[model samples]
Every structure is written in C-alpha cells, then in structure tokens.
Target: MTGSLTIGTLAKQAAVNVETIRFYQRRRLLDEPDKPPGGIRRYTQTHARRIRFIKEAQKLGFGLDEVADLLALEDGRHCREVEEIAGHKLAVVRERMTQLSKIEKLLVVLVGRCHGNSGKVRCPLIASLESATA
Candidate 1:
C-alpha cells in the first residue's frame, strides 16, 4: 500500500462502508483528512485501525460514547479502566439474562396452559395480560 489511502480504500481495508466512516467522522470519532486543492483526501493505516477498533468495541456492546472513551485510552496504558468498563457490561448482561430467563419461564407456562385447555373460553395467556394492566 501507499503512504496513505483514499477513503474508499480505507473503508475496504477496515471492512466497513464509506458511509460508516463518514458517519464516524461526523460524530467526531474519526478525523477527516484535509482535501488538497482539487484533490481527494487520504486516510492512513491509523485511521483504518481506529475504525476497526470502534467496530470491535461496538460488537462487544460498547456504545459510541463508550467507544470514544475507550479510544481516548487506546494508548495501552489503562488496563484497570478497560477492566472496569468490561465488568460493568458483564454485570448488565448478567442482569438481562436473569430477566430473560424469567420471561421465558412465564411464556412457557402461558403456552402450556394454552395447549392443555379444552373448555375455557378465555385464553389464560390473554386473560393474564389483560388482567395485569387492569
């Protein structure tokens, strides 16, 4: 590769779309290269790496704000800070899983009731939902 690449090449190398790169630039998460007189701007490997980092962080459930925070600490000097973020995310995921488990159990009970019924004109699931709001 050359010293720098065009936005399209950077996007291709980063496995992201051009619009995503533009959006990141608009969000101040990425730096937009200066366009020379009648010439296209170019991106460097640093830019590509930043895009990949943001994408990977997002995949791990980090929001844009969180990703920016992580990016600011990307100098590889804040292990403890990174761990703190990961810990909080893990806690949130665990709480969500617990809630989902309860919901799953409730759904199973409702579906089982529906399957076992032969006489009741009122659906137990519907009745439960309607009564809960009333």
Candidate 2:
C-alpha cells in the first residue's frame, strides 16, 4: 500500500461511508488532507485506523465530543486523564442503568395491574402515567 488511498478507499478500509469521513473532518475528529492543484485529496491507512478508533469508542458509548477528547490524548502520555474520562463514563452508565431499573420495575407493576384489571373502564398504566405527570 503506497499511502495514496483515496477517500472512498479509506472509507471502505475503515468500514464507513465517505460522508462519515467527511463528517469527522467537519467535526475536527479527523484531518482533511489538502488537495494539490487540480488534484484530489488522499487518505492513508492511518486515517482508516483513526476512523476505526472513533467507531470503537462510540461502540463503548462515548459521544463524539468525548471521542475528540480521547483523540487529543492519543499520544499515550495521558493515561491518567484517559482513566478519569473512562471512570466518569462508567459512573454515568451506572446511574443510567439504575434509573432504567427503576423504570423497569414501575413498568412491571403497572403492566401487572393492567393485566389484572382487564376490561376495566381505565387502564392502570395510563392512569399511572397521567398521575405522575400531574
């Protein structure tokens, strides 16, 4: 490989579309190579790898902004800072899980009530939602 990959080829190597690469460039998450006079911009395997890194981070629930931060610290000299970011993300995930669990429990109880009171004039789930909002 001659490090002369076109954007389309780079996207293919990274398993993303060309527009995804463009969007990352727009967000400053990826660099936009300069095109020479009357020539096209090119990409390389490094660019593809960077796109993969962004995609994997997203898979682990990091937002684009967080990904940008991680990218900024990618020189391997910011381990502690990286850990702090990961720790904060873990805490947020835990809190969200706790909230979802409570919602699940409430839904279970409401669903059971609805089943038990089938054919009633009002649905227990609907009543619960209306009262909660009120």
Candidate 3:
C-alpha cells in the first residue's frame, strides 16, 4: 500500500496468501528481496502488481508455467509472442468447450432415457454407463 511492505503485507495487497508469495519467489515469478542483517525483507508495490498479474493470468486458464512465459514477455516489445501464446491458449479452451458440449448432449439424452423408463427394468443411465465401459 505504502512505499515498502513486508511479505505478509504484499500478499494482502495482492489478495493471496503469504505462502503464495513465497511459492512465486521459488517459482521465479516474483523476485525475493534481500534481507538486511537482523532485519526483515521488504517488498514493493511492484511485487504486489506482479502477483496480481499472475493471479489474473491463472483465472484466464493459464497454468503457472504459461504464466511464467507470459511474465517473460511482459516487456512491450514482445506483443507478437504474447499474442501467439494467447492464441494457443484460446484454441485449447475452445476445444475443451466443444468436448464439454458433447458431454452435455450425452447427459441430456441419458437423462431423457432414464425418465422414459417405466421402472420395469434396469436403470437406463446405469445400463448406458455399463455399456460405455464394456
């Protein structure tokens, strides 16, 4: 918030846990400041901003490794590289969405079959699942 902050303060500012800050430091996503003799390590608003950036990227389905790549290209000179990475992620998301849509259609059909059953035989949903495994 102010000029300098501790790790806890930085995590609070970034809306993450203190351990998350340390993990980021270990992951090389955030820089760990040197501690003075008998004193605590200080963090800056810049560190908080970096954590927020990592979090936002993750919320958009970027893994930590991908976030690391994005961070490496944060300098404005690498827009093309960033765009390529983002385009790839978008393609993955689109494919996953297509798969999910197919799953949803199958679920709808299975539930419909279950509803139409007269309760005189085995459950349609269960039979469908068994057949799938078979």
Candidate 4:
C-alpha cells in the first residue's frame, strides 16, 4: 500500500494466476503499468478490479472481445448500448442451449444401448458417432 503493487501482488488480489494476468496484458484486456526508473512496474487496485471483472465476465460466457465491449460500457457513457449487446448474447446462449439439449438426448440414447454385457467391438458410443457422420 505504500507504493504501487507488483504483478504478483495484483494477481494475488485478483484471485487469478500470475500467468493469467500476463495473458490479459498480452491480450490488451489489462494495461501494463509503467515501470519506474530502476524499479519494477506496479499495478493499482483498479488493475486488480479489472482483472476480476474480466474473469467474471468470461465465467458468464462472454468472450474476450465481448468483455472488452462490456468494459467500454462500464466507462459510464455507453449505458444505453449495453442492452443491445446483452440481448444478442442472450440469443446466442439460447441457441447453444438448444444444441446442447439435442446432444444430450443423443448421448442418452447411445448410453442406453450399452448394455455393458456386449464386447468392446460393439461400443454404442462409437457407433453413434460413426453413424452421425455417415
């Protein structure tokens, strides 16, 4: 707290790995702080917060590019644009859910056919995948 924090300190506070912070820097999602003369660069709490925000956004299925747009909206001038972006993301989520449900149904049927008494030569899971492609 006396001086600015180092990358390790920022990573610890953000609850992420040091390499993750570096990756964010490389991706331009987080800014690299300037190093002082004969000293290492230090990150402020804002950097830690931004890293947390990016991680949380990713957990919610937002890609890095979308997270960057969300960060822009956090700048207080793009409040109105957030809704449009979120709506599009919701539509995408719904589509993925539909696709996942279809996959789940197929997996259920495939698993049901595996009576566990058959030899490995007749594996239903492999059969299902092969048939789908054919």
Return the lDDT, model 4, position 6: 89
- Model 3 CA deviation exceeding 4 Å by range: 75-134
lDDT string, candidate 2, 37-112, tens digits: 8999988888988999999989867799988877877755467887887677768778656655666777877677
Q: For each candidate in the order shown, give its overall lDDT on alpha carbons.
A: 0.80, 0.81, 0.80, 0.77
Q: How many residue pairs clash in each candidate?
A: 0, 0, 0, 0
**Local accuracy of candidate 4 as per-residue lDDT tens digits, 1-134:** 63468888888889999999989889888888876889888889889889989988898688999888777666655545768876777787786676566667777766776658475533345544455446
Give model 4's TM-score versus the native structure.
0.57
Q: Candidates' TM-scores?
A: 0.56, 0.59, 0.59, 0.57
lDDT of 1 by residue, 28-86 (tens): 89989889989999899999889999998888677899788767666554778878866
Return the top candidate by lDDT. 2
lDDT of 4: 0.77
Worst 10 residues of 2 by lDDT: 121-130
Model 4: worst 10 consecutive residues (lDDT sum)? 121-130
The sequence of per-residue lDDT tens digits that candidate 3 reaches over residues 40-127 is 9999988889999999889867799988877777744467877887688677788656656666666887677778677644334455
| lDDT at position 10, candidate 1 | 91
lDDT of 3 at 16: 98
Candidate 1 achieves a global lDDT of 0.80
